[model samples]
Target: MISFINVDCTFGKKAGIKNVNFTINSGDFVFLTGPSGAGKSTILRLIYMDLFPEKGKVSIRNFDSSTIRNHEIPFLRRRVGMIFQDFNLLQDRDVYENVALSLYVSHYKTREIKNRVYEVLNQVGLGHRVHFYPSELSGGEQQRVAVARAIVKEPVVLLADEPTGNLDPRVSLELINLLNKINQRGTAIIVATHNYALIPRIPNARLFQMEEGEVTKIT
Candidate 1:
């Protein structure tokens, strides 16, 4: 449901993606693997329209980066979820509040928001920590909160950049397994990371390797 056609986006003299082309179908699980500056994160940004292509275009369903207006970006975002290496949970807010904030912004009813937040937190294995602050959770638990926050809105596609970068290997594997489960339930997932070792853990996932901002292989 997402396509990047001959896309070229550059941020500076030596940083950005070039001639990147790919398609992610619905319910698909894909991995973007390469070293730093290989344009993995750039590809995710393009999908979410955080960075418009300098040439070519990015299309996610009906929304096209080439023609989408700024006001419509928020609507687009509601269908796409994103997580990062660093858990971006609100330090002062409890887990329940963090996940519910998205629904609140979208003006969901209070009862519906409560149900959705509880369901997602449980999906991420954090139902018991609903009232705990970010500081009270472990690294993995905090990242689970981040995942819950991202998926609470039931996004169509989830974009995760270096999601396992901050966790230990065991915790990273657990996180990957959790994401795989989410993918199985129909939401397409695209993860960008440099961890080749983790790729094997995700069976049937398509792998796209990059080098110097260009895709080098698809396996």
Candidate 2:
């Protein structure tokens, strides 16, 4: 449900993505892999409309970056979830509060928000840590909190940029497996990572390789 048509975006002297083109179907699991500076993150940004294309356009369902208004960006974001290498949990808040932030912003009823947050946290294997602060959790648990925060709103697509960058290999594997489970339940997932070794773990996923900001291979 996402398409990038002949997209081109650049930053200063560094090349962004050049004439990049791809489509991610609904409920699909895709991996964008390449060396550093290969534009994998750029592609994710385009999908989320965090960066506008200098040329061409990015379309996610009915919203088009070429014509989307700034006021409507928040609405677009409500349908898209994102996770990062560094867990961006609120240090001052507990896990429940952190995940509840998304629903609160969307103005969900108090009872509904409580139920959704508990459900997602349990799905990510963090039900017991609901009241724990970020400092009280391990790295893996913290990332799980991040995942719970991203998915609590039941986003249509989840974007993860270097999600496993901070964890050990075992934890990375667990995180990917969790994401796969989420994908199976119907939310499309697009992960931008440099870890080629992890690609084999998700054998059925679509693979897109990039080089110098252009997609060099797709499998």
Candidate 3:
């Protein structure tokens, strides 16, 4: 559901991505891997419409990235879920509220919000910690909450940027399994990370390696 054709991106004067072309199909799990500053996150941003290409084309589903309207962004975002490297939780909100915030912002029915949040919490194995504050949870638990927040809307595409960057190896493996579960349910998964060890454990995941602002697919 994601494709980039001869795309290029520059930040002010420096190049961010150049001559990058790839495709990520629906219901497929793909990994974007490379060293730091290799344009992994840049490519993810392009898919999520956070950064538009300087040239060529990018299409998510039927929406073209270059010409997407500002008003249509919210609708687009609802179909694309992003997991930041840093757990971008609302510090003051409890786990339940943090996950439910997305539904609230979308103005979903109050009752629906409660049910959906709890359902996702259960999926992520965080149902028992629903009322805990962010500070009270361990790093892995916080990351699980982030995953719950991303999936509570049942997004068609899930993009994770260095999802296991801050966790122990055991926690990292658990998170990968969670992503795999989500993929099994038919959501397309795109993970941008530098963790090479974890890549081998996932079967049928294609790799997109970036270096010097260029991307090459290594299936």
Candidate 4:
């Protein structure tokens, strides 16, 4: 559902993807692996329309970077969930409130928002901690909360950038397993990670190895 066609997006003199061509089909598990500054995160940003290519084009479903308007970005984002390396939760808001904030911003009905938030939290194994704050939960639980927030909208594709960067090995493994479960339910997953060890845990996942802002290999 996403394709990068001969794209060259550069910034800060020398950091971005070059001539990158690939397609991520629906429900596929794809990993972007490389050292820091290798354009992995750039790919994710392109998918979400956060950054447009300077040379070619990025197409996500029907939203084309070449011609997409600013007004339509919000609509595109609703269908593309994003998880970051850092848990960007609101420390002041409870778990339920943090997850529900997105729905509220989208103007979902009050009752539906409540139900959807709880449903998603349960899916990520955070049903019992709905009332807890981010600080009250462990690192893994907090990350799960981020995942729940991302999936509560039932996005067609989920993009995670170094999602396990802050967790221990065991917790990171658990997070990957949780993502696999979410993928099984039909949401496509694209994870940009430098941790090569986590790549093997997901069977049949497509791997893209990038270098110096370009995709050097795909397996």
CA lDDT, candidate 1, residue 14? 66
User: How many clashes in each structure?
Assistant: 0, 0, 0, 0
Model 3 alpha-carbon miss at residue 132, Å: 0.3
Local accuracy of candidate 2 as per-residue lDDT tens digits, 1-219: 899899999998778999998888887899999989999999999888899999998999899999999999998898899999999999999999999997888899999999999999999999899999999999999999999999988889999999999999999999999999999999999999987778888878999999999998888
lDDT of 1 at 54: 89
Relative to the true structure, how large is the alpha-carbon lDDT of every model? Answer: 0.92, 0.92, 0.91, 0.94
For candidate 1, what is the TM-score?
0.98
Could you tell which candidate, 2 or 4, scores higher by lDDT?
Answer: 4
Question: For model 4, how does the per-residue alpha-carbon lDDT over 35-135 read when each residue is reduced to its tens digit?
Answer: 88999999999999999999989998999999999999999999999999888999999999999999999999999999999899999999899999999
Displacement of residue 72 (Cα, Å) in model 3 is 0.4
Ranked candidates (lDDT, high to low): 4, 2, 1, 3
TM-score of 4: 0.98
Candidate 3 per-residue lDDT over residues 109-148, each given as its tens digit: 9999999999999999998999999999999999999999
Question: What TM-score, over all chains together, does every model reach?
Answer: 0.98, 0.98, 0.98, 0.98
Clashing pairs in 4: none
State how far residue 47 of model 2 sits from its true place (Å). 1.2
